[model samples]
Target: MFSYCTDPAALDGLAWFSCYLTTGKHMSIYYAVGTVLLLLAITAPLSLAFGFGGATAARSQILPLRWFGNTYIAIVRGVPDIAFFLFFVIALDQAFEYLRHRIKCPDWEAEVWQGNDFIVCAAAKLPLGNAPQWVHETYGFSLAVLTFAIVFGAFAANVLFGAMRAVPRGQIETAEAYGMTSRQTFWRVIVPQMWVYALPGLSNLWMVLIKATPLLFLLGVEDIVYWARELGGTKTPQFTDYPHGDWRMWYFLALLVFYLGFTKISEVVLDRIMARLTHGQAAAAGEAQRKAAA
Candidate 1:
């Protein structure tokens, strides 16, 4: 912040705006942007991994494993995301504390569920009662990331399951005829060919995931939307310096620009990835690429 910021009232025009934008709270808004990006970066791959596992399990020859995978995908996909986020976070948090309580306070005799409230021993408090602010924030963030992964993973699993099936049966037969075991056939022929079919659905899922970042606000994470609404509200001089009228429209406009720009960049990247995956394959996309190259 500039030295002129010391007397915000005396400042005007660009000087006033510069100091206003550099305030501690404003810096928090900047950090919130990074928070959103970080959430996406961590959640995307985690969700994909979960999806891959679910899809693999769903396709397993073992009846119980297949049932488990199918049930997971069906239940998660059927539930509304907002309902899942709200319920799952509380349930998961309590589940963790319950396990810890059993281990750390086995001698304690108080009931965990008392009509309305869920309580655990002080020793079992996540991050402890005296942990630093950042630890609490990190714990909440981790929960949000897990919740996002689980929910999106279900959808991704469905996409991948269908993609896996779409791989030509003849390819698997050919691989097996070449002395490949079932595992070898899947790894060599099925896995490589499935991506071209999966990419379209996965790309749409990526876009949905990006849009869903705002739900972090509901999860108690101070994301960009939270900061935007807080900072954009009408700020009277009675409350603080550099007061401004309602500016939420401007704040949200910036968010719109950010999301649009980010998704546009994602589209370009996904297209390139799709091109790479399709290269030299037998799919229609591969045929088109070959024609274009020729």
Candidate 2:
């Protein structure tokens, strides 16, 4: 980033540090921050959509639909998240390849699981065997995002389901009395009122989702943690221009500050949202707002 950074070995003090931080590997660390932010932006809404659908389905009039939704929530939430992450990514990846194998290589007569190996045709490989590096990285990241969405979506579903139930029965009854159908009552009456109740739980879930971004390493993505360990490790003179002792502590300290700042900002935003949602509702929060305004 600096003209003075041309020779890292000759530099000293702040100049040396400046050149060190400007290295290509360190640039990747900055990009990793953006990656984390991108994952959060995409995953939040996707998880919410999944949760909403799961919560609505759990309350469906049809028995089978309700059973399916309930089972989804129960099973996913019941299992440890790490276990689910490890299992689901492999399963979903194989399942995708299996479908592709059926479509691309119908004539092939090989079993997919042949004694500890998942054998699929070359055409069936996701991104193909000769695909570019970016394709492979994107495929892995996509799988990680889906795993996060599914696991957290289950928790969000449980929060939303309870929130839906917490809406006063009288409100729903009044909608029914006003000639609203079940669907209409749900959308117009129940949905609007449930947000205030759900906000706290959802806020907590959002924090959890933020914290869970580090787990991306487990999914084979070269995330911030991977970069920190790589760049901060002891680098001998033979390896590169920049040589440093174990700096993992400093790297981790920076990460800690990053998360703390992110969560604090989130706290401010969610508090404002909660206050806005509380206006004119029957909940105690809404009542407090009304009294304060008076």
Candidate 3:
């Protein structure tokens, strides 16, 4: 980044370090951190929406609807999440490719699973065999994000489902007494009140989602972890213009700090939201606020 970094070999001390870190690969690593943030920004709302639908399904008045919703939430919780990430990405990908294969290569007579290999015509490939590098990365990243949304959505659903139940029965009863129908009671009385109770669990789930971002590396996305490992290592003359000793520990230390700061910030924000939600409620926090006001 600095003009003095022109000759990495000649540059010494901070100069060599600056040029080394500014290399294209290192720049990619830096950009990957932003990718992590982007994933979180996108996934949070998507997951919340998924969770809301799941919770609603579980509480639906219809028997089959309730069973389906409950089953979706229950099955996701029952399975190990890593297993789901691995299986679902591949399963969803293959399913996509299979459907494409069916249409694109109708004349081709090759089974998709021939023994251990998943053989499909090149025409059915996700980004196509000859597509640009960016498409492949985009495809992989999309799958990773989808996987994250699915897994975290399930956890959020469970939290929300409990939160919905936490809404006082009398609140619903009072709504009905006011001539509100079942749907009206749920939407106006239950839905609005549930957020306060759900905030704590949802906040915890948010922390978990933050921690889980690193797992994106396993999904083949070039996230911060990938960059930290790639660029943080000692460079030899053969590998780069600047040579250094082992520094992965320091790189990972940075990652730890990054995560800690992120989690702490999230905690502060959630706490503030909780306080706002508790402003006039009959919860403990609300009672404390009322006493302080008096």
Candidate 1 lDDT score at position 188: 86
TM-score of each: 0.98, 0.98, 0.95
Which digits, one per residue and each the tens of the lDDT, describe model 1 over residues 1-294? 888789998999999999999999999999999989999999999999999999999999999999999999999999999999999998999999999999999998989999999999999989799999999999999999999999999999999999999999988888888899988988888888899999999999999999999999878899999999999999999987979999999999999999999999999999999999999998999999899999
lDDT of model 3 at position 67:
94
Misplaced by over 4 Å in model 3 are none
Q: Candidate 2 deviates by what RMSD?
A: 0.9
Rank list by TM-score: 1, 2, 3
Please give the range of 10 consecutive residues that has the lowest summed lDDT in model 3.
8-17
Local accuracy of candidate 2 as per-residue lDDT tens digits, 164-244: 999999999999999999989999999999999999999999999999998898888888988989888999999988998
TM-score of 1: 0.98
Comparing 1 and 2 by lDDT, which wins?
1
**Candidate 3, residues 254-294: lDDT per residue as tens digits?**
99999999999998999899999999999888999999999
Worst 10 residues of 2 by lDDT: 1-10
Error of 3 at 52 (Å): 0.8
RMSD of model 3 against the true structure = 1.4
Q: How do these models rank on lDDT, best leading?
A: 1, 2, 3
Error of 3 at 44 (Å): 0.7
List residue ranges in candidate 1 displaced over 4 A. Answer: none
